[model samples]
Target chain A: LAKTTQPISMDSYEGQEVNITCSHNNIATNDYITWYQQFPSQGPRFIIQGYKTKVTNEVASLFIPADRKSSTLSLPRVSLSDTAVYYCLVVENDMRFGAGTRLTVKP
Target chain B: GAGVSQSPSNKVTEKGKDVELRCDPISGHTALYWYRQSLGQGLEFLIYFQGNSAPDKSGLPSDRFSAERTGGSVSTLTIQRTQQEDSAVYLCASSLTPRGGPSYEQYFGPGTRLTVT
Candidate 1:
């Protein structure tokens, strides 16, 4: 598992596109970049994952650069319900979490 | 279609007492994991079980903390002589297989909140 660094918090108004960037300079070749969303009093939910380039799903998008040292999660048309903690992880078989970026979508 | 489930959503015990927490992984899932999260803190990996065997128990905080999985489906985490520091939310997750598999995305349980007095 590779360690990741991300912003402590971010704020956006409803209807805005929000992008949270994470840095994992020591990523391994087999490591995959994955993201999760967590709300208060609930377990984390898987959002998206990618090895390289870009991967998109109904919930969000993950963009991994060519170097694979960093990645970004793009959330489109944010709403008040989208407010939650976003976590970025680089892992192969192990699971670890950092102080995720808390996104606050204000009305 | 059910996800991982945990028993005793909350537990409160004295410092010298023992407590047990249970987790039921998703059906047919071969991998299970246990993690603890303190208030406003990142999750701390405690153990991992592949099938019925636990290959990684290094994350267990101390000797007093132990876990076992039977039938590769249900797991129990037991804590003896609980201390106040042991208070935290214990979570469980399971995937069809470990990472690198076609469907390794983990599904998590709501977690058991333990409060040791």
Candidate 2:
């Protein structure tokens, strides 16, 4: 399993865009970059996933550089409800998690 | 459609005793997983079951922690001689298939909060 590193926490105001980056220097070829959002007292929900380049969804966007050593999760038009823990995982078969980036969106 | 569901949303047990947590995955899902999350901590993978294959138990913390998936739908995680450290939220997730591709998404249940006193 590849180890992932992300910021401990991030703060953003409403209507702002929040970008969280994760570093996985030892990512494998078969590993895919996936992001999950976890609110307090709830299970993590899938936000977006990508193998390389860019992938966007109704909720967020995932940017994986050519090197694939790092990936970024971009959230547009942030709101207070967007406050949650964002986890970036690089996995193929074994799905492990790291200390996720806690995003606090203020009104 | 109904999402994943877990039983005994909250449980309080005494130390040195045993406890069981149950999970019901989504219908037609062939992959199920168990994870543990301590307060303010990230999820820790416990085990995984894919199709009829042998479960992947490499992530289980100890021999005392065991899980079984019967009929490939319902799963139970059992902890023997539970200690205070065993207190945490047990989460269960299921996906349509195992590593089909980058599109695979794991749907999670609300989880079971266990407190060992």
Candidate 3:
């Protein structure tokens, strides 16, 4: 499993774009980058996943660089309800979770 | 469609007692997993079951912790002689599996909060 590092917390205003970066220096060739959103007292929910380049979905977009050493999760036009803890995980077959970045979208 | 479901959302047991937690996965999902999460800690893998084969119990913390999945649809995680450290949120997830193919993304259920006194 690849270890990931991310900020503990980030604050952004409503309607603004937010980007959370995760560093996985030991990422393997077959590993995929996955981001999940977690609210208090609830299990984490999958937001986006990507192996390379950029993958966009209705909820969020995952940007993986050419090196694959890092990836970014971008949320556009955030609202107050979007405030939640974001987890970045790198996995091949088994799953591992990090402390995650707590994104606070304030109005 | 129904999502994953777990029973006994909250449990409070005294020390030296045993407790059982149950999970019912979504329809058509063949892979199930159990994980524990403590306050301020990351999710810790406990065990995994794929179809009717033997489970991967490598992540079980201690001998007192054990889980069983019957008929590949429902699972029960048992904790014998519970201790204070066993108090945490126990989560269950399930994913689709194909022969020789990778397991699909896991769908999680609301966890059961266990408090061992």
TM-score of 3: 0.94
Model 1 C-alpha lDDT per residue in residues B36-102, reported as the tens digit of each score: 9899887888998887554588789999999999877899999999999999999998888675533
TM-score of candidate 2's A chain against the true A chain: 0.96
Model 2 alpha-carbon drift over 4 Å, by segment: none
Model 1 per-residue lDDT tens digits across residues A17-77: 9999999999998788889898988888889989899999998988999999999999999
Off-target runs (Cα >4 Å) in candidate 1 are: B100-102
Number of the candidate with higher lDDT, 1 or 3: 1
- Classify candidate 3 by CAPRI docking class: acceptable
lDDT for position A46 in model 2: 91
Pairs that collide in candidate 2 are: none
lDDT of 2: 0.94
Arrange candidates, best TM-score first.
2, 1, 3
Question: Rounded to one decimal, what is candidate 2's iRMSD?
Answer: 1.4
Q: Give the least accurate 10-residue stretch of model 2 chain A, judged by summed lDDT.
A: A90-99
